[model samples]
Target: MVDIEKKIIEIIKHKPVILKKIYELLQAENKEDRRLIRKTAKKMLSDGIAYKDSKNKYHLVSSKQVVGTIEFTKSGNMAFLSDKNGDEIAITVENSLNAMHKDRVLIEKIGQWRDLPSGRVIRILNNEIERIVGQFQKKKMFGFVIPLNGKINYDFYISPENMNNAKEGEIVEVEILKHKSKNKNPEGKIIKILGKPGDPSIDLPIIITKHGLPNPGEFPKKVMEEALKIPEKISKKEFKGRKDFRDQLIFTIDGDTAKDFDDAVGLKKLNNGNYELGVHIADVSHYVNDNSDLNKEAYKRSTSIYLINTVIPMLPHELSDWICSLVQDEDRLTMSLIMEINKDGDVVKSNIYNGIINSKKRLTYSKANKILENNADENLMEEIGFLKETLESMKELMYIIRENRKRRGSILDIESGEVYFEFDENGYVKDILKRERGISEKIIEEFMIKANETVAEFFDIKGLPFIYRVHENPDGEMLIQLKNYLEILGIKFKIPETMHPKVLQEILEKTKDHPLNESIQKLLVRSMKRAIYSNNNIGHFGLASNSYTHFTSPIRRYPDLIVHKMLKKYIEGKNDLKKQDIEKYSKILPDISESCSKKERVADEAEWDLIDMKKIEYIRKHIGEKYEVFVTGVTKFGLFVEIPEKMINGLIHISELDDYFIYNERDNSLVGDKTKKTYRVGDKIKAVVAKADKLTLQVDFIPYENYIKINKKNTKNYFNKKNKNGNKKTFKKKGKNK
Candidate 1:
């Protein structure tokens, strides 16, 4: 068989010939040889090894060709596409099928001359984007909207009829009409004109509309009216059959700007030497009835969107802020989870109840941290002794809970510090600061996670229908890539006997304090599957839990509201919760989960865009200002630097480097080809802000004129192994949340 296959290939080496010609050329006189030839030809064609075109001639499929999703770089010079089989291929923009970033495409290998194969797009399987955010420019009869995002290389052509009277040079949202052949550009229509791109208030609206996010202005009036009708004051009749915790010293802790507080905490020591910890979440489901206008609106939005300048809430303010918020000194409906925890952080007993509470006080993270860390308030210490003890006891309990969680192999990704923006009276940026998560934030987080776990366990044991938050195990191929990258950073950990969360958590801890910590963590996070809502109990791999669901923050998230309703029904003596309503929801929960997850991602992207725009605007004014920055990445063309104060990254272009430099592929560094000077990853240098482009989110930096190159002795090939595809020195992937 092997001899026949090779002989046949040699016979047709130069060109594809007719099958009749092949049968004659082979001199097959007997039926046996003829049968073997036909069998081989059929096998080759069926397995994609050979194919016959319209002319009825056979040809071998070119090597290294496949179909995958094409991801673009910020500059659009090159593209990489990867499929589920772990195969990756690269192609140049010229070979791209006008495939926008993240679009699926069919590609064929053009050459194998280089170590890595180069491909050309044959067909586009899917164009994932439907619209874009851009600036409109009027033409003679029509117009073009230039995409603000750099990955979108094509400008959308718009006709005058679809312009909607948009002015020239205004930021606008355009809906994509068509994206035809590779030779043609994508066409679109102007749906909304957001004022000037630099306008603080106007840009946000354009982003929201561009992403198709829910808008507060378009909220249903029926839902608004129903929310307003909910009384501010709690009536006596509404408190019946509800546990009243108004006398308890329950209070809320949140950010200083938080208005719609969702969860509150109270703690006390039991006479039996145990502790009773209460986690009370606002009963938003009580006010927003099932299948009502308010409920439907909340389901549509799925999650509240917090942006730089404003919030797009999941529910109207009348319900989220005024009626359901756990405000201080106000009666609010709540669903409380009271756990009696022993000294070892084990729950001895637990109960869930429909309750009412009046918060004693509202504490901000700053003040709460002070009370935990400082013992200087003498006058208030005597009067607020209980408050102090409550906090101290809570801290003790938090330690035990956190320790137990770590033991359970829960993975924590404390990767990046949040860049917080404070605006001036005129809506311009006043200050930018990096806010590290402190103990106060963890106190609330630990308790909420415990409560959610408890609720999920209760439902699971009773065999009830419920919505769960599940994160599947990370992709093995991605993990292998991550492990290779970590080895480059001089970090190491066990890969587990098979695959689990503990080993990843161990690696996460080892990457801290180094300059590459944030980037490494980000890469590891990108390797893992996204956490999502589901009815099937797959168990959360990241949390390392047997059962888990979101049972807190119903005021800001819809799934929590659903959980609240279920809890209420079960606590009211229907423990199994196997009613017709439960069965109906169980059937549709998969679709609901999918829709909510997609919207959550959209909300996240929109929020990030708003922040990125504001950051660029704020940084642009500081052009020519020099600041020290750490070298987070060393690319073929430039060095990527992260500013300490702003926590934002900018590029130090190779052209900006005084001496001409050549990229060193093996070491992930750059060397002055003539001067013998070098720049390595993790080095600190000062550079002036050369440019900050809001439209493209591009920031460039240049070294100070007098700054000298370190030229320090360094290791060789530190970043030697490029990610999976043929070790291209310029292997780069752009976009965020990775």
Candidate 2:
């Protein structure tokens, strides 16, 4: 068969051939030989080694043709596919050939488009869009569903019978009945009605349904049953070989609303004056046995999705929020990492073992920060007085560890830009606030980093099959782009061919006091690749660590659960690993890592979408309100502005200016052609909200001067500003000049 395949490939490589001609060329027309030849040719076509044209002629796949997954841009205007050599080729909407996002397709290189390699999808090997979440719109006779996912351009056609009694404006999940084609929209039946738009209850469901994640607080019956079978209280049998730490001064620090306490911390001063730091993570592996329904469900979810107030957990609430959560004053099983560190923050010795812990207290970051900064009130200080010494020592050690991380060239001080929401009595968002990471957050972060690194190093030295959280270095092209962007801000630095985190660290330090620090950091972050879980250990570029893995938060993250199980097996084997177990793990870990990475991305995107939706919803109530915003970005189409007070970003179109504007690429500015007005990063302007769309997650703003011009009769007595030309009729700002 191999010989026959080779002959067929060789024949087709020279020139495209019909089946009969190939048989004639090879002279293998016998019954058995014909069967084998035809089978081999079919296999080659399916495996992308060859492709059959419309004329039923076979041709070998060459550099001119590539087979890969189609990745669509957010707006669905363009797509990208990678060749065998991992080079990206752009595919415009017209050339997409109706291929959906993530669909495997074969594309032929047509030519160059916009200075990049371009292609047209010739054939789709796989159709990945089976279900879609969209808004149902009823027409005169029938209805269609408009997809909420920005990457899917076509509206799903729904006949009158397939409407499933769904309302006109309700969000619905559609099961694709027929795929889209050149002239026909995809046909689907409404399978589920999520809810109506603007209903606070439906916000999360929209994102959840769109991403195909498990609905919040819901799990499979079998998985839930299995979780219910696990004992809520620790049994004597479970305590075997586990060290006892119930009497230790251990505690958990998380957000005020956080219910799943996955890790607890403890500290003590060693005999030699070194600091002993203890990180106890919930032993979820003990309960979620391999090959069990609970384990399978955990793997399916991969990681918990935190969408503001709702949490779609990997494990059921019976496990994640109960038995496995390190609730205060409750005995629970855990895997503990004990490390002895010197004053310089170097871990001289470390130990990992099964253990039991009783969290003495549950503290929120706000209260913990107050204790750490000595700003706690009298009653609060007295209540935590017993933990005073340990808390102070923990704070001191956090800074030391942070400094050590800095010494090793870790990129730190990047703002998270996380936001929190305040809700009205009716569950509607009333205000959005920025979440500030304080000392207590840093303490937990540093400790988890050390613990994860220690466990990874231990397994790395033993050469065991393991999963690693790896962040590869930024691409050279993206770094060049970053350099160009930085130069526009008057910060010029040459990026090296082989860049290090420290180099970026130094650049961040240079911008520490710059007004555009957040924007700069966000740009640099975009220039870097997203961190992912991988079976291969390539080291983590962001953390500047030679070894790293997710060892904490097993209750929320599946990778951590897997790490716990792997660590247990290695420890039980006492460094004498078995060949069969290693072989089994080595085969499965790669797929598991890839699945987890993909799921993690989906969770992040869902969370971001929900947040952006809520932000738009909040802005909708104040449509005519004016805000002082900073120009965070400038382009030919518009200026990207952020309201610092609210931490919400919006766009002011170039046409919104009083005069036509030209984009100056060198200075990264938009200049008004007539007024000589300029808008650049860090420039502040007053703007009024022009529009906000929850569907697109976009906020549009126009200068206040334009708003005044449109409403001069109502505001003529209030505005007393003059333009640069000394015209009292013109205000400094304008609205909706477009």
**lDDT of the candidates, in the order given:** 0.77, 0.86
**lDDT tens digits, residues 386-434, model 1?**
5777888888888888887888888865545678888888788877888
* TM-scores, one per candidate: 0.74, 0.86
TM-score of 1: 0.74
Which consecutive 10 residues in model 1 have the weakest lDDT in total? 725-734
Provide the lDDT at 10 for model 2.
91
lDDT of residue 577 for candidate 1 = 69
**Candidate 1 ranges with C-alpha deviation above 4 Å:** 1-132, 149-153, 159-168, 173-193, 375-386, 412-416, 475-491, 507-529, 579-582, 633-639, 652-683, 702-738
Model 2 off-target regions past 4 Å? Answer: 1-68, 82-89, 108-117, 165-168, 193-195, 475-489, 709-711, 714-738
Candidate 2 global TM-score: 0.86
Positional deviation of residue 18's Cα in model 2 after best superposition, in angstroms? 20
Assess the local accuracy of residue 677 in candidate 2 as a C-alpha lDDT between 0 and 100.
Answer: 88
Quick one: best lDDT, which candidate? Answer: 2
